[model samples]
Target chain A: MDADVEAARPWVAEASPTFITLIDQNHLLSSLYNMVNVPQAVWIDEQGRVVRPTETGGSIDILREFDPEAGAFKPEAMARAGAAKALYMEAVEDWARNGADSRFAYDPDAARQRVSRQTPETMLAHAKFQLGRHLASLGRVVEAEALFTECRELHPDSWNIFRETTEKMDTGIAAGEAFWGKVMGLGEKQYYASIDMDGMP
Target chain B: MTIVLTETSNSECVAAPSTTDLWLDADAVTAATGWTLKPEGFCKDDICVPTPADAENYVADGKVNVASFWRLMDRPAAASKDGDVWFLGEGATERNDALLSLEAPDFTLPDFSGKLHSLTDFRRQRVLLITWASW
Candidate 1:
């Protein structure tokens, strides 16, 4: 979900997927599902319910390999970027064919268990984010910036908020210096939350 | 009391007066959220919950204390420094229920052509929703 629709449309057209591709300028999906990062995913059954909450969707921060100064990845350092993606892609195909019977799909209890529980802080963070975004839409940049900064502080795990807020404010380079700052700041913490499918290493 | 303008994901609410206690007049409550105050409590459609037993704490003069109402509805609320912008967030219990039902929370979004699409429109078929951004 990006505010800049025209900028991203060309790339999406180039891919030319058969499925429907929609733009979420309001970040509705992320807010509804409590998603904190892009390249994350959720599976839904025919009934229109979420079977998977949020998975890292094979993004392993290859962006980190890009030196902000050089603006490119170090040679050979990007090898494993989509390493697990092939496996996940295969699983989706199986799911399409087998429906809920696919081993990749989670059952009701398990699926419910997997959905992230919203906390007081998370809810409040979202509130701050909404208010900030509204102000930004109204061109109240200074006010929006303050609320967005508060949103990031309240929900540090929400890289979506952090990245989007930083990008909107034209603060630091969100994809470059800002990205590395987030990654490096996570000292000893796991950047990606582990997925539970078999044959995933 | 100062009137604070507010808007939600879809609708603009009646300009509710600012109250440190979150006491919104009856009209503001309906406009801010679809739920309407009833004898039982605040309700929308078939779902209803009892308002707090202490009537004086909730109903005073003509305003209803929405903060107390929100607690019963299980919503979390926030507003800007001036309270001009208010957001009442979805509660945990309701989100949990949607998960248990295994029904995907449907949304309407626009395509490159600006045509709207709803997830429910694709129902009767499985969907693999992969979220990505140009960032």
Candidate 2:
């Protein structure tokens, strides 16, 4: 459970029950839980049924404390993270008390539908990322670069995809910053775009 | 996505790309790692690979045969020069095995501090696995 929740650190520091944070080095848990985006969560019951699908959780009101316009740090990203956290936290609470009977729990059909909603574009990006990883491992840097570029173009909002692509490209590879930075900038721009589109305050 | 497994008396190996091109399945992996791929996934005692898929066609077609598939992929085979068998192949190479299933393979990964952990460790606990980068 590797997470960057500086906003929640204060709350966690002030909490009562003991809580431990696990750093997921390879995103094994994130992939297992189908957490495609930041602040997404899935609540699985003892029987292994997902009581709550991945949804935005936690409180976004905390963003009110930060200034987005400040240099280096984008406030809109903070706000988006907050909204996602709020939704996820709300779902968690619903599942915690109600168990299987919780209104938040999806029927098998709904769960399947939710899984299917991942969208072909998203799935293709995953494939492209995987293929890039494969090619990179094979020492075919050029081919891997192309695949990763396509992946970024398709999934511009995924920080993980962009980061992994850049890391695989390494520093010695030419056009490293220009190619990778373009995607990083796009992600930031999308973050701001999302806030405006959602009409978030 | 076919998983091809080829076996020899002393060893077995898995190859991929196309099972016809290489043996990339559980049996071959077991030969390489001394573990077996089962329905429950790759297992060596309690630890498992968890990326199990059918490799019948690959095996039957001899795509997993070490020597045959190596030649097909232009990968080198074990060469003995000084009485020590040196297996040669590009390390850190990624292979496309295809989307066998959406199920995530369960395994404990070693962190920077050399600690092994798994998703089950966070069961019944609140966890946030944030995948991000400094860049």
- Off-target runs (Cα >4 Å) in candidate 2 are A1-20, A28-34, A57-91, A101-103, A116-147, A153-157, A166-201, B1-20, B23-107, B110-113, B120-135
lDDT tens readout by residue for model 1, A1-201: 665676567778889889888887656666677788877888888888677767778656454466658766865545555556778788888889998889888887898787776566766677667767776787888988998888888889988777777753243236656766788888666566668887665
DockQ of 1: 0.59
Model 2 chain B lowest lDDT segment of ten: B91-100
Q: Candidate 2: lDDT over CA atoms? A: 0.42
| C-alpha RMSD for every candidate | 3.4, 10.8
TM-score for the first chain of model 2?
0.50
Off by over 4 Å in 1: A61-77, A167-173, B1-9, B16-28, B53-57, B60-62, B71-74
Clashes of 2: 24
In model 1, the clashing pairs are: A48-B103, A48-B104, A49-B102, A49-B103, A49-B104
